[model samples]
Target: MNAPVATSLLHPEFVQRPVPEALVQALATRFGSQCSTALAVREQHGRDEGAIAAPPPSAVVFAESTQDVQDAVRLCAQHGVPVIAYGAGSSLEGHLLAVEGGISIDVSRMNRILSVNTEDLTVTVQPGITRKQLNDAIKDTGFFFPIDPGADASIGGMTSTRASGTNAVRYGTMRENVLSLEVVTANGEVIRTGNRAKKSAAGYDLTRLMVGSEGTLGIFTEITVRLYPLPEAVSAAVCSFPSIEAAVHTVIQTIQVGVPIARVELIDVNSVRMVNAYSKLSLREEPMLLMEFHGSPTGVKEQAEMVQEIAGEFGGNAFEWAERPEDRTRLFTARHNAYFAAVSSRPGCRCITTDACVPISRLADALLDCVTEADASGIPYFLVGHVGDGNFHFGYLINPDSEDERTRAEQLNQQLVQRAIALGGTCTGEHGVGIHKQGFLREEAGDGAVQMMRAIKQALDPQNILNPGKIFTLQ
Candidate 1:
């Protein structure tokens, strides 16, 4: 048990397949000014928001189109070199780390809305487009993509990680929102997984398979996603609770009672304090539920009233409403920045983040004990969750220079994942099982299921050139 955590803490020592000089020259000749070997650019593409450390990729290829991605991948495949896909670089689980030395194919320049089909309620976009960019572009059409994963993460990356955020409890995650994809296979072949039809009796469900593949199975070039119409009326509210359990129980009851709450998030007292200091807002320093309701004015009012009554049963304070658009934006912006706020609370500290999601019935049982354990561990941390779906995160802040701190934090994370799995939940909720959660993934999925996944990976990417050394090691 300790061994897995230790392995997770140390940077993976996979055999680094050297990027042959011939391949580098080929990339330079093909891509011309688009290929860069400069140290700064390589370093920038090497790591992400995750704490894991690894040497920068040998080169960074800026892919501006689907053909560019295909060309870069083809060149790498010929040389048997690893390829790591880069987007907004906002993934929290080390998903973008170039663990086995390779070249990073950055798709940020490929950002563009290919088409918007209002009648179909779907939008086709290049992988590089961020969620915020997509929403801003489609806002005037009375439709918006609802997968808001806090950061302005790329649609491609979000789709790759199968991310869902504040709106997931209502609109669903990337797994449900993504209708189809144009993917570049390991051998540089482009394939369309499905069409924009809402339902299909296809031979295989490749779209779902690729949605959360973490860039291991293939590279995404184009994505078609379902969109929701902007609500006729929306309201945001914050209600404080006397204790963490009370706040969690309120969410559990809200969910169990079928409140149809659009977005419901849990922010612990520690995180609220951090947000207060970082965002310069005086939210009550107590466990709080930040909620949103969307529908007709009457429907929204009824939902809010029902939730307020439920909160009252759990010793919650009065609801502070944010009905105006700007006010709601300000409140949600602060919620989105909870991660940065926690990081800012402790200067020079790195966070060992935990994503543990249990069943709604087990949320209180899973969360309360973990809270007690975290407090007793003497680690400064912040707890926040999209608890409307029984998914929560604990960001354990630790000194980068202290091995003991890292070990302690990993231990806490291990325990948290164990409890969540025991409660019939996943090791990761929105964050995919990047390098960080590979051990927990095996525990959750069992050896036989993992072997089946390995077989699929072997069949799709025989050379292991696509984002090698992620999810689970091939060996």
Candidate 2:
């Protein structure tokens, strides 16, 4: 293990990378009480939600402001030490693993809503604020941030991963929601990019450059995200289908017909069963579409009627709608708990969440075939999707001690990813590659594109000090 976080060395690779002790001393002196070398704390913050391995960080720093990030980064640059930016520790792709251990800068404290520009429909917030926190703060303002990445993730981590969930089908992902950023470049200078205005004739869209960069190019201090007006009329509905194909086809046709669906989600029969047993959600045990319509009362009425007609043509079960605030809350809460239900299907088992997206026309075929494949494999897998976007997740459960099962699951995951690539879709629609997709990046983005990304990395972080050994390996 590294000189720091010498504890939690049960795994061979956890924080074993070399770190300069003199650099740590210098940083410690500079940050004083703000810096910490406590092994337990560092270990706690370093773990990610990856199935491969979750390593701990060597050191930890609770950053209070952008200046603190600058001080820590400058020290790491001088010493050529790796720095890992820690968020809420909810990264499913091992994005926060301190592979080359040094200091893990935790931005949990810098969570303040700097400004809510209602005129521009944007909210400027410190990256550390969680999505739920942001929503709660702006609940009374009639504006909401809508990227729901499953986890109550920090805005910074979500931006780093370009994360999204059910709401993205209507509200869009981080790439679409983020309007600008206050980022600290490798040189430790905090600068602002993008503007409060909706459109910009600016030179380069550097604001978006950092959205999915995963902290490789720079550190995000503040994020300005586009917000949506709370719907004047809203309703949630569930439409059960006889088969996955029928449900997917319904989603496609609903969108094709110009139905302004806010969230159209699919849960296969197996997934519904898991949620019923685990979350005590007594919904019908069938392939179902959980949908939301947002607009004026007349618009919502028209959209709901059109959606119901489409579902009926496909032999869908009777559709049920919830419009009251309490009913809406209950419906969405159950929807959000789909992941927990999948994991709890096998008590005390870790989850393997594999996500992908395909063209809307091909979504039905892909999902139907995947359900067949999942059933044939005889593994516990839950099928759920943001139907309107053709992006879905197969949440698989495996006991940590079952090596053979884990290996089989890995093979299944590889097959799924390959299938998605063949269909002209991304291996990960919203989740950043992190360590999980490093090998597959080339198969998606060609060698030349990868090379350019590496060149940018070298230029920004000459010392390879800011979140090193991520996005691309230093050659």
Candidate 3:
């Protein structure tokens, strides 16, 4: 296997190659109008939500079907050019950046809900279908996909990142929900990972491998994910806390005692203010916990009452419930827009978002320390988290044009990640280790573990043509 590429995340070095005339001509000939070399198109596919600079791909292939992806990958592999998969452009870790100029396979057009087996509580979809779109399609069936990553990100991207959001506390993350995947490997071979059976003593667990592979191992053409029956009674509530510590402790205690909370999100005072202004909601600007419960009416009531008592122990105020569907939508939409709300709070500023997760017992310690450090840094910031699962983020707002600010943001992120690792937590909770967390991943997983991962990459992608310069580099 190739030795681990010695590179710096701050100034990553990629093997950039010009898109060969022959390869471009071949792709254009095959895809016809679906292919593009326009600067505008290349620019869009070159970056994601992260604050990273990388060169745009030489060309883009708007793949409409699995065959299209296979055709594109096969030709790119033959030419020994990198292939970066593009989904919703919502990844926070720079997963979609075309650091090595080549062909970008835009799968957004491949979006099609192939099948919905309501009886089996599962759905198979093309890589391009967004989570919200999938839910809308299956809403009438009394079942829905629950992995919401704030962004209306494509299911394929979520699968790629192994994402989990508010609903993860109850419904689990993409790793748990995904049952099978249809992946196009680096060498242009198509393979299916698993079957529809809920449980299996499957060999190798390739589905799990590809779920969070970030398109390095393969390009996902079709994905079959588990769905859940919509809760008969749904309710949302917001509870204000006297302090961030109090709010966190309440969450810790609620989880320890088992409240069966569907979603429990924490919004620090700063985030509340930003969201209030952005979403035009009149909410108390304090450390607050936004929660949702799903169950039968009586069961939901019991869960809420149990959680209320737990929160009261930590100085939580009265629970303000959103009973109407519209009210609940407005509340959650504001929560989901936390990142945008934070950015809007400081115009001309970008955020270095941190996704640090810890053990439930250490949640309060990890979160409080990270928040305190960010506060002391004097960088304008907002904090939000799926704290129910001991996961949280601090969106440190920084001026992209200011070198000093960028350095400070990166320092803060590094410190937070190290602290999480010290506390038996991951540098990233849901956001995969794209270019952003490559260094931290090495620190957390150790050299041996990372070596095994690199070995797998080398074995599967000897040419290194699949999303090169991500996760870890091999040379």
* Index of the highest-lDDT prediction: 1
TM-score of each: 0.98, 0.94, 0.98
Each prediction's number of clashing residue pairs:
0, 0, 0
* Candidate 2 lDDT (Cα, 0 to 1): 0.82
Model 1: lDDT to the true structure? 0.92
Candidate 2 structure quality by residue, lDDT tens digits, 312-388? 99998869988888987777777778888777778888877788899888897777777777788777888888979
Q: Rank the candidates by TM-score, best first.
A: 1, 3, 2
Candidate 1 ranges beyond 4 A from true positions: 1-7
- Each candidate's lDDT (Cα)? 0.92, 0.82, 0.90
TM-score, candidate number 3: 0.98
By summed lDDT, the worst window of 10 consecutive residues in model 3 runs over 1-10
Q: Show pairs that collide, candidate 2.
A: none
How many angstroms is residue 308 displaced in model 1 relative to the true structure, after the best TM-score fit? 0.6
